[model samples]
Target: MKKSFNGNNVEICAPAGSWESLSAAIRASADSVYFGVEKLNMRARASENFTAGDMAKISRICRKSGVKPYLALNTIIYDSDIPEMKRICDSAKSAGISAIIASDIAAIEYASSINMPVHLSVQANVSNIEAVRFFAKFADVIILARELSLGQISGIVRAIEKEKIIGPSGKPVRIELFAHGALCVSISGKCYMSLAAYDTSANRGDCYQPCRRRYIVKDEETGFEMAIDNQYVMSPKDLCTIRILDKILDAGVSVLKIEGRGRAPDYVSSVTGAYKKAAGLWNKGRFSISAAKKLEVGLESVFNRGFWHGGYYLGDKAGEWSGISGSAATLKKIHIGEILNYFHKAGIAEINLSAGGLETGDEILITGHTTGARKMKIGSLRIEGKSAVRALKGQVATFPTDFKTRKNDKVYLLVPSS
Candidate 1:
């Protein structure tokens, strides 16, 4: 891992929407995991958020695995949300949460009053050194505005050190950057398109993502309408920095955050693992162009709206808009079936094929709440004690495996995209 100016290794923070994604992040060697609980977070409507009751368990899991857990309470807070916010913060503090990622002043002030560590969320749109110094009074870490350039970020980092600005922890404030994930066309993701259209405020955690859809431009005077040409104009491509990760590390960032709390467990696992490997390679001066390309291929196999560096980091003003309405991942998952039983001693898993069939040499992914995400290839298969090359739908098949899979774990076959 790349070390920041403070000599601490840069942290890789992954996102978790569910227990499965949390486990997957840990399995992929994430330094920390951030997640939403209840409706007080930005991904509240997009993900299966944990309840306040789940805080202890989540903290315990992360503690046992040596991964820090950050509770995201960064949505726009209303007066009615004060009680719930306080309850959640109390729960997090009691549960030993590492930190709270917050944007609203209400959440930040309450968290500070309770003496709990806080990390400024991107919603705060902190862009300048003065903003960092101000937030440093309440937070130990600050995620800079996504619109800032590398030169700007470097300047802020330098100012933090030169100005001797320290956080509530009495240590130098850490800077975090969004290393990879979906990019919003809005400035620092503070858009009100959802609220303007559907009465659902994106700031309140219920984003209707009107930007991801196709739109038609209509002439109000002439009643002439024309569809935009093959582009989701408002939706920018997903941000990918693996190619320029060394430059990011050189900027003295203390944390690399992967944003996907609403995505699948496998997506978390794949992206976190890729960044982890890339960071390690970078520290050893082995992050060559070929290595980055290989890691990028692994990334493209997962969920993405097409990859772009974004003008924010490179200082290009033009937008890299998404051409498609959804993911342009190179590989897609096909639901095959679920595991019926696992014969531990025999190292075999009995599966009931409910949908698609599986053939030898086919790669399969097994995902579950406890199992997380596990991928393996089918070397051989058996059906009713007879050796078989393929297991069709409705057939009970047994396959040898190295890892243990739990009952009801969904299985998927990875296939090439059309």
Candidate 2:
């Protein structure tokens, strides 16, 4: 972990939408993880949310791994939804969750009444010092608005220290920033395009993502139609700050949050590992341009809408839009098979190949609720107790592995994207 200019250890906060993503984040060295449950979070419709019964298990796993767990209850609340919202907050507190990330005043006040810590969500659009001072009454940490410049963030940080503003924790309020992942074109993600187009409210966590599609302009009188060539005009490029991480830390930001609760396990692993490694290098004074560039390439192997430094962070007034429709990842995974059994003592795994064949030296990935995301190269292969160079479909192959894998874990082969 790197230390910020204010002498606080910079934290890497990762997103987890499922057990697989949570496990991957822990293994990849994330200091804290945030997740959604029971359709009360901003990513509710985009992710496979956990149930109330899974709270204890999630807390236990995070505690055993020395990672803090945060439950997100940031969605807009209706009068009818208050009962369920309170139930979730009470459950999180009883289960030993570190904090609740919230936006609505109702959720914030409810959590505070139960003595549970709170971190203000980005949906609050806290941009200036006065907003920080106001929200400091309820939240110990406030994720600043994504559209602020570095100078604005630094000013707010300085104000917190000078005014001696403290939260319910009796400590000065800390500032968190979004260091990577999807960039919403709307102001602090308060968008109505999804609701207006698909009748799904983004504030209620059910956005249809209509902004990522292509569009054209039509003239009413002339009957002319012109397509926006080769660009998704409403979609902004994903934020990537590995190269400028030191600058962000120098700005006195405490937490670097990655925004991807809807992503896959491999995406969670790759992004978390990349940021962790870059932070370590920055702490050691080894985060050179070449090293940062290499890390960015590793990030490109996973899900992304292309990379760009956030416009406002760099003092730019215009947005950098994505040229393509979907992810621009350099590599994609193909389903190969599933695990049949694991020989723990022999350090071997027996796999039932249902699709693509596996060859020696081939790169493979295994993902499951327990196994997480494990990537390794095949050293040798054996089919039906006979030595072989390759294993084809419908055959059971045994391969040596240093890590434990569970039965029914999905296996995949890595291939270059077209």
Candidate 3:
């Protein structure tokens, strides 16, 4: 698929922790989706990692949606892990994964053996043009280190183009950067705090997030201990570049990636949807400050960690991290109703309207384990078997839908901003 920017194609890669997230990303207009394999992916514990069978299913779903699926083999590996790695590579190849993001050299070699397109993971920390040039020999795409500033990224891209360093595809190595999501206090893939605190390697997909924990300061000579001024001193606020997206685009990156695989389908939808719209406007030179503020508000409405900043992309001017709580202050989503039953042939779904009643003409998103966020307007609503304009908070309502809704699926009313 050709991902376009402005009039040119550029990818808007979204995270897929589950099938619901995958569907949400696609519906939100993500150009591509990235997910992890079971057991060996960086988000193995955080996400519902795909099994071999699940990979084939994912491939079909992505293909049907016209979105490319990239496998995340981007985790530390051991010598004994090669066999499982190769098996995964073979499976991903058969499943038609667009590429495999790998951090370990052995994992890269194994993926290369299967002729899968390799993307150097952010774990590799490709900061300089020299590193980009070196990886160009093997990797089709390079996910630049998160610590890089726009100036640094621009220089690297220029140097690569000037040097004519070609990737496996006989074209310049594609640059992908994290445009939104959680920011790690430690450098990407270089942290040993998790290892020291939990005896689990962060690189091996087993981080216990020691950085998000409170710590006490101690003076060894006096043998005195004092609580830190702020508890979550290590955690940084989440990254939100909606305000300076055009500057990021000028840095010559091909893909803008959102970083939330452990997040819900709603999160994936809201974040990706906002960025997708903003990037399109930016490309067309139609983006404005008012539009950016609106987009920022929409992003915060989904989930956030207090506030946002440009992160390392703005260099030291990005300012001090404000997230002292080491946790996301996600907004509480309003509940409209929950699915009770569905009369499939009748194209009607019975919902127990418990909170915030729904009115006719209101926009809603239906989400569940199997029901990937389906968005539609309430054309009609019935309460207690009677045609009604609205369903009260305590009423059991039924509504006609174009898609089948499963039991337990949640209905969220999308209220227009005043």
Candidate 4:
């Protein structure tokens, strides 16, 4: 998908929190990022929220990286707090913010007071043709609610095109969509189920993910109980439509969003890398991207709950499931040193991991983070720079195998689940 937005380039907009995640998003080729500050973002409970000052620094980083930085001012505010809210928005505006998300009607007024561009958040739940048209009246862009089908999105686009809603510069409003990550069980993300039950609010950026928690349903007739949470009845696995990203770009969707506010840095890197490659391969009419092997290989080491679906890209049949419990296993343990110059070279044949859990010798795959594949075997063994009888953890060992591994290739010791 082309990252061109109108006359400008369109790029992936990934979620970021800490410096590591921000760096990862940029390294993976994301064009922009959205995150919460200490007060306004939805993930307040997350460890890596930007302070008021931190956000200014982050703005600098974004400019240096040539990426845009957008702030989420999405929480509902009362009438009494407009003054303080204006101050925050003004500070963000001074930092060269691309946009600020607003859910309340007053958000438009507040944004105009500070002369900041406003994007209507999906929390507004502007469904149907008329609702989208209404939202476009105030927003420079709109993040469409995630419940729409491709046909529905097409319809929404037609509505906007017909109305000619003003864009950031009064050209035409941009329409962004969520292409990847966890989906809300609720339609408009207005569920009070979490706040009412756990005292945590999904609004104002502090969702405790009570959906991931277990629950018991009461039976009115028999008064019996039914387990809910562990079964993951409400918690759907993350949505990953990276393979069909082109279909979305063609839809004229302004931004391809990845949903992960509290995710690991490496996770951001892997997911961003996959989408980056896919988007690059996407041409307006010519389709010659055959990097299926590359995409699969790249996704192996990233943290995922398993079960990647086409999401709304193939229509609503793409209902998501719960995330896998063992997504952290992607990082494997491998032999310490398989090659003397593995760090410098690329295409090495076979590489050997430490014999920690191996019986005598076992065939394995050497998956490099950036280098792709370097499969090899183990015959001779050296521990602490000397020939060793067996491999053990905490022992320095060098065994010859296949792939020319460099310092960049993280060696994961593979052991499949039983």
Candidate 5:
């Protein structure tokens, strides 16, 4: 959708893992991002979740780039987990997070009292106008549940606009949705499979995701058995709204989200990049969602369960999760090096190599938190106070660092450049 839906603004929020994916989100087109820490995140165990220290740094990077960072407090809070959720909200405020995605009412209440903006998380199951408005009384935005239809969202967005209670300064409390990524066939993210099968509670941020596992329904009648398909009975295909970006963007909503904080770096990078490009075009008034077919390849480069569907955008269809799953993906770029400094004066990419690695004329690539990369040959690289003619064994010598890389970044070097 164009930045305007009949003159209204549209924004996009993506998922992030480490500083790399967070920066990638900004570089790509994410108007904002949502990530989780170990406490209240469902995917805390799956993705490279962020730490408090990392948020202190990454939040600054996001602010500088005009990209918002959201702290996910979306997990259902059991009786014992309330204190931890409080800590998460308090810490997020200290780190300057743009907002917090909340599901529990107490979590919402606590977050509302804080200075930060509250985006009602999907776990709240806020699918209607009144529910959205009720949360709007506290939340700055309402994230629709994954099980919502297009019609349901459209109605809620209209109600949100009707509310006179504006945001901190005088803006209407906006609406948000899960425009993409894996879907759970559970109710409002309250899955019992984890608790029932493995005694793991999804609300406690310890889900085993038994729903994604394969299952066979056997007939109880005289022990009759029938095998229809493979596992992943409840594993719905990922939500790919790239095809329906315009509808989502123009839905009078403030942010369209891609759901994957616990995903891999490749997934975070590629999916975030594709949506970033799309949103960039939309913001620039060159509206194109479906027209950006060329960008779709980036999404496939990462780990996906295949079977793309607009879920709820199209009429009801079966096998959303009944398809045979795809295989794992192995992408280039493994974690190999670290950033020492950025010698912008010499315009060289300075990086520190571990072990007896650097050889004369070897090329290394340096990627910064905010910068993609800067490539230069080892033949022309330099070490501290002297040319790195041969980087010594077990010593940390600075190599051509022209990419303006800062310390504390995970630099990746593609050896032999395959």
Candidate 6:
């Protein structure tokens, strides 16, 4: 049955939080990236958003690395925020942003006025053909709501094909889908809990993540309230679509978006690289259960908030909406070395290599009480002030560090989850 499927022209889109994550995405072979400029994007509150002056640099870097950069302006806009929004839109146009992911009608109109391409954000709640037809007038692409099933997505694709909505390039409009990442407890990420809790609207990019907090369930009529104990009733499991890549592609989605702008570089590289390989396998008509499991292990190793599920892709099953009873962290790291000495002035830390060897481009995770868990790659490795590619098992290796480390901070080599 898989032999009948085709995966040609499918694009893998990743998230970029900073230059480190951006470079990691490119190295992992992501075809494109979606990022925020400042506080205008939904993930801006949790991410280190770029400044306006960094727009041109972002465009140049992505283009040079053979990747496309899409500016995300998906937050709601108020009347008082019009001028600044217009300025950002104008800067996006000048920076050659591939497309603007927007939810506001004003943003759509601004993109149209500036002759910039637009993509309808999922925040638009586009579930039916009517909504698609309406947004088709302003957007070249419409990201479907996350609540749709595979059959429903196929139906929407068929319906749009009949509408004859041409894209900005005069071709048929494209459909993009969220293939992986965190799932929202609310209906398509339109939640009011944050506003109710702290008067900060999530749609306005000031969310406080009230959903991840502990809560007590209560019955008003009986006046009874009790704690669930170790369970987050409102937290949904992260989404993983590796097992259903063929089905999604068969539904006519040309772009697959991986959601994570607030994650570490290792997370970006691991997830994006796994999907890139998975999509390639599907295109070759060789996708199998073992291949999917391998990809799943890689995903679990980097991060798994509550675990993974098919999410809405599995449809309205009885337990599809239930939350998890605690998060699970997998993927044990291999002990490599321990901190020996530090040259704080030079931003370098010396490690007494013991177990595993160190090589350039190898990712290392440093952990301590004060240092926490910081992940970085070996951009430069030295042995006694001389450049070295691979530090042997007993050699003292020196690598650059960004944060202050304690005397006994441990270093571990990160690998795919076993």
- What TM-score does each of the candidates earn? 0.98, 0.97, 0.88, 0.75, 0.78, 0.80
Q: In terms of TM-score, which candidate is stronger, 1 or 4?
A: 1
Candidate 6 C-alpha error for residue 70, in Å: 0.3
Q: Report residue 122 deviation for candidate 4 (angstroms).
A: 2.0
lDDT per residue, candidate 4, 218-240, as tens digits? 89999999865456567666677
What order do you get sorting by TM-score, best first? 1, 2, 3, 6, 5, 4
Q: lDDT per residue, candidate 2, 1-418, as tens digits?
A: 4577456677899999999999989999899999999888999899889998899999999999999999999988999999999999999999999999999999999999999999999999998998998899899999998888889988888888888888999988989999999988799858999999999989989999888988788899998998766558889899888888877777889899998999999999999999988888887777777898888887999999898865578778646889888789998899999999999999999999998799999998999988888899999999888888999988889999989999999999988898
In terms of TM-score, the best-performing candidate is: 1
Error of 4 at 299 (Å): 3.7
**Superior candidate under TM-score, 2 versus 6:** 2
Candidate 2 ranges beyond 4 A from true positions: none
Q: Please write out the lDDT profile of model 1 over residues 1-418, one tens digit for every residue.
A: 4578777887999999998899889999999999999999999899999998999999999999999999999999999999999999999999999999999999999999999999999999998997997899999999988888899999999998898899999899999999999988898857999999999989988999999998778899999998666557898899999988888888889899999999999999999999999899988777777888889988999999998863478887747888888899988999999999999999999999999899999999999988888889999999999999999999999999999999999999999998
Residue-level lDDT of model 5, residues 263-294, one tens digit each, is 64546667777776766676676756456666
Off by over 4 Å in 4: 1-8, 79-83, 216-230, 284-297, 317-319, 323-418
Q: Write down the RMSD of candidate 1 (Cα, Å).
A: 1.2
How accurate locally is residue 349 in candidate 2, as Cα lDDT from 0 to 100?
A: 96
- Residue 322 local lDDT, model 1: 86
Model with the higher lDDT, candidate 2 or 6: 2
Residue 206 error, candidate 4, Å: 1.9
C-alpha lDDT score of every prediction, in listed order: 0.92, 0.90, 0.83, 0.66, 0.68, 0.80
TM-score of 6: 0.80
Model 6 C-alpha RMSD vs. true structure (Å) is 6.8
The 10 consecutive residues of candidate 1 with the worst lDDT sum are 309-318
lDDT tens readout by residue for model 3, 148-227 = 99999888877877777889888777889999998788888898888897798888888887776667788999989986
